[model samples]
Target chain A: MMNCQGCRDDLVAYLDEELEQSMQAQVEDHLERCVSCRQEHDSLRQSYEFTETYLSSLEPSPYLWTRISAGLRGEPMPVRAPWSWLAARISNSAVAVRLAAVAILVLGVGSSWLFYHERKLTGQARQEMVQFVADWEGLDVSRVNPFLARHEHPVDELEANPFIDLHHHDIKNPFRHEER
Target chain B: MKRPKTEARAEDERIGELQEWLQRSKQQDLEAFHQLYQRYSKRILNYIYRMTGSVADAEDLTQETFVSAFQNLKKLKDDGKFESWLFTIARNNVYQQFRKKQIPVGSLDAGGEEERSEYERIAAPVRDPQEEALYSELQHVVNEVIEELPEKYREVFVLSAIQHYDYKRISEIVGRSLASVKTDIHRARLRVRDRVKRYLGQSS
Candidate 1:
């Protein structure tokens, strides 16, 4: 013998068929006796039916596929820039527009400062590298160039063996000579 | 609606064809993947639209969902779970968009007069003028109720009612326990019923 509150608590689950068979029977029993509980059940059922009927799924715009395909290909949509869209969304607010301008101005100035600082640092690094190379130019080349001596030897060997083809060629028919 | 046996059989056949398409898509078959997109794009679009209430946001989020899904399709281990996987991607994208915009939960600004007008314009037509007016009013009320629902309840409610996902599938899509999803859906349904009772009373 379930009370009205207990029955009401289980009504949603019973309607959803989520309740066990025994508990569902208890709800049904309560509904049979209690008009209030039964009305509540009907109201809940009607709400479900109403929403499911009226809140129908909509057909997306025809161009949605085009946009999706373009997106999948990493192409931007054939629409205005995002900032322009944002501007339109907040176009009614003069304050928002002014704030956006301020933010953009701040960003522009900050980036310019950063760029200038980066360039100055890069120029200093280049100057330091030039000075270091100039200082190192007086050092003996032999200590650093073990391959320099071997490089000349390879050139001399190549000159001596100018006609000696380094590439291997297989003669399929050594005895067969073309008629000149 | 209960489908007839023949219809169910046809549905099964379609599911088989879809599985084939899924496999070919995994092989980088563009045509096969396009077939998948054609089949599912509308459902995904509508689901996102209902969730966001703003058509523009829904369109962008739906595109992001499909793009993300395609990019990460190779990471998906099971072909059978593609629908839920795609839904998970959509849910994540919607949440990310919400976070990025910092839109408060249950804010009218999220879907205001513009969304209402768009919804009314696209609602199904009724034969009688008076009936059409009544239906439109009811639609407005219902849409308001949905848009006003808290974010947590909104997702589960939309998934269960509008998307027709089962409790288990909704749980999977939302990454919540079955008990929690069920509780949220129950509460959401009650909330919708209470809010729309006035319009429903008039119409009935």
Candidate 2:
């Protein structure tokens, strides 16, 4: 008869029905001959049976299942997004590619818009600048108050110097003295 | 003759109905998606709860799994393998999580991939539980014990003990040989047995 330890060793496999035919026979022989091994086998079997029962009886959390079912209805579950799966399957480059295309389109449209606006603005600025210069040139200086309402020129006094007038007055007498 | 014909017609009609549902779901029909959800939610929830130790996380993961499965159902190559495919998707999701945790257990490295697969064979060890009442406690202990075990062993233990997957399926899941899976499971069981015994002795 095999000892308690030998039966104990095989007891797990026996409960699982995983032992080979030869080993199975050996365990059977040991069980029949050894009371201690038999008791151990029974305990081990019960333990395994207990585990199976308990495991099977376990109920999943109710609220979580409710959310899961709801999520199946096209609602996104935040906490369980399976980001790793998403990451492995979807690349940032794909998104970047689409975004780059969009940016190029936007830039194309924006550049065209700016070019049109800039051309218009430049034309307007040139027109305004030319109109300003023409208006300045068209100003009638003869009618302009600053030039027409002539302020006194101190130089006119020099032109009409009293000394010169006196000299002329006296010289006129000297030239006409003989005749007088 | 009429009865047989009617029965055949009925079976065909049922299959046709399910097929239509499958097609509608693939077409992103919300109502169809809901119908599918209603059909399998409970079973899936239970399955997830068993796989994951937390009822809360299981529930959340279950919902997430379904949402993902619904969105990607169109990608399924064979609609007939929906059950296994769905489960596989769920399994993939779960493994992604374990991988995300980035917790490394010991290496099961054999020389080549074959060498590595050999380690997986003795990885999952089924620990013995003494009684039915202690089963739940045992499961809790089992989960804890698995976490404590090396990575290769943990994978084997989880697949065989908690997930109750056959060696062939586990072989496919882990990409190892059937022989390797068997050995890994055997070794895992032994480790679990020793750990649980020690843990129980300490607690008592």
Candidate 3:
């Protein structure tokens, strides 16, 4: 025999006829032994039946079906396509492709011009270093060991010095795409 | 007279045919596409209406739902539960509307929200009036309570209680385990029961 609480717990399933025959028999035995449980079960049973009956009778508002049918057909729905389509269009069109190629050509010419310009500046810098060394030698203002002996440092030594190479090395190429 | 009977029978046959066509439509059958639409358009509309509470939005969502279903029918892994799959899409569209704050436009009634939170809450408050006066009200409460449930629970309860689906069928429709479906429905019923008790107490 089932307890009142157990019977009550299974009441909803029982009312819906979902319990197995053996379980249903146990519930019946419990209900027979307990009137309060029986009464509560009866009330729950009535409410569920009432809810089902009530809900079925309530149809969707008039024209609800008509409007929904129209919608399912995509007759008047509005939505925008995604942005990737625009990017694809700009990238794929003949004109866009040509424009990209022309831009690449312009960039290539500009880079070469910068490289040549840098090389010319480096040559001018080396020439200036040589002139400065010559002028310093001609100025030889440090003399006069009573015999007026000149401390002659060779111009070639100054020219061949590592310091000259440090100053003469080209500044970094601003447009160099490749790592130096 | 013969033509009217023939037409009615034809319509019924067409609906049955559409259900069949829906399966093939998942494989990109255009003929199935047209036939399915002819049969299920109204039913889908009613479903959307119940979800959104507005005919205009229901109509728009219904159209989008079908077109999307049509386009992505291939993505439906389970063909036997096509109607459920379709409704899932429709449900998603309706939820999307709610997310956009477009449904029940122009109102933020707290009572409405409360009623909507669980079927039992709204249903419990309903009095036993004459069948005519109370029937519509009961339906209203049912709709409201269903609306109030958390999305996952509400979906199961609506499928089982309102749609009258068996737990196995609902599980198949929703792609969940049968046990999970049963538990969701049970929890949903418990929530409704609490609401009903509260409503009964307040009304009395």
Error of 1 at A54 (Å): 2.3
Q: Which stretches of candidate 1 lie over 4 Å from their true place?
A: A20-23, A74-76, A79-180, B1-8, B106-111, B119-123, B199-204
Off by over 4 Å in 2: A1-14, A17-44, A53-58, A61-66, A69-73, A76-180, B1-57, B77-81, B98-143, B199-204
The TM-score obtained by model 1 is 0.68
Model 2 Cα lDDT, one tens digit per residue, B1-204: 157988999988867776777889899886777667666666566555434433444456676678788788879887666665666766676566557755332221111122212222243235555553354455456545655667677766666676676676677666788778777777777676666667778879
**Interface Cα root-mean-square deviation for all models:** 3.5, 12.3, 12.8
Please give the ranking of all candidate structures by TM-score, highest first, separated by commas.
1, 3, 2
Question: Against the true two-chain complex, what DockQ does each candidate achieve?
Answer: 0.19, 0.08, 0.06
Best of the candidates, TM-score: 1
Q: How accurate is candidate 2 locally (lDDT)?
A: 0.59
Q: TM-score of the candidate numbered 2?
A: 0.45
Better of 2 and 3 by TM-score: 3
TM-score of each: 0.68, 0.45, 0.50
Report the lDDT tens digits of candidate 3 across residue range B103-145: 4522223332222322234334455668646655655666565
Candidate 3: misplaced stretches above 4 Å? A17-25, A56-180, B1-19, B23-55, B98-131, B141-152, B193-204
Task: Evaluate all candidate structures by whole-model CA lDDT and list the values in order.
Answer: 0.73, 0.59, 0.61
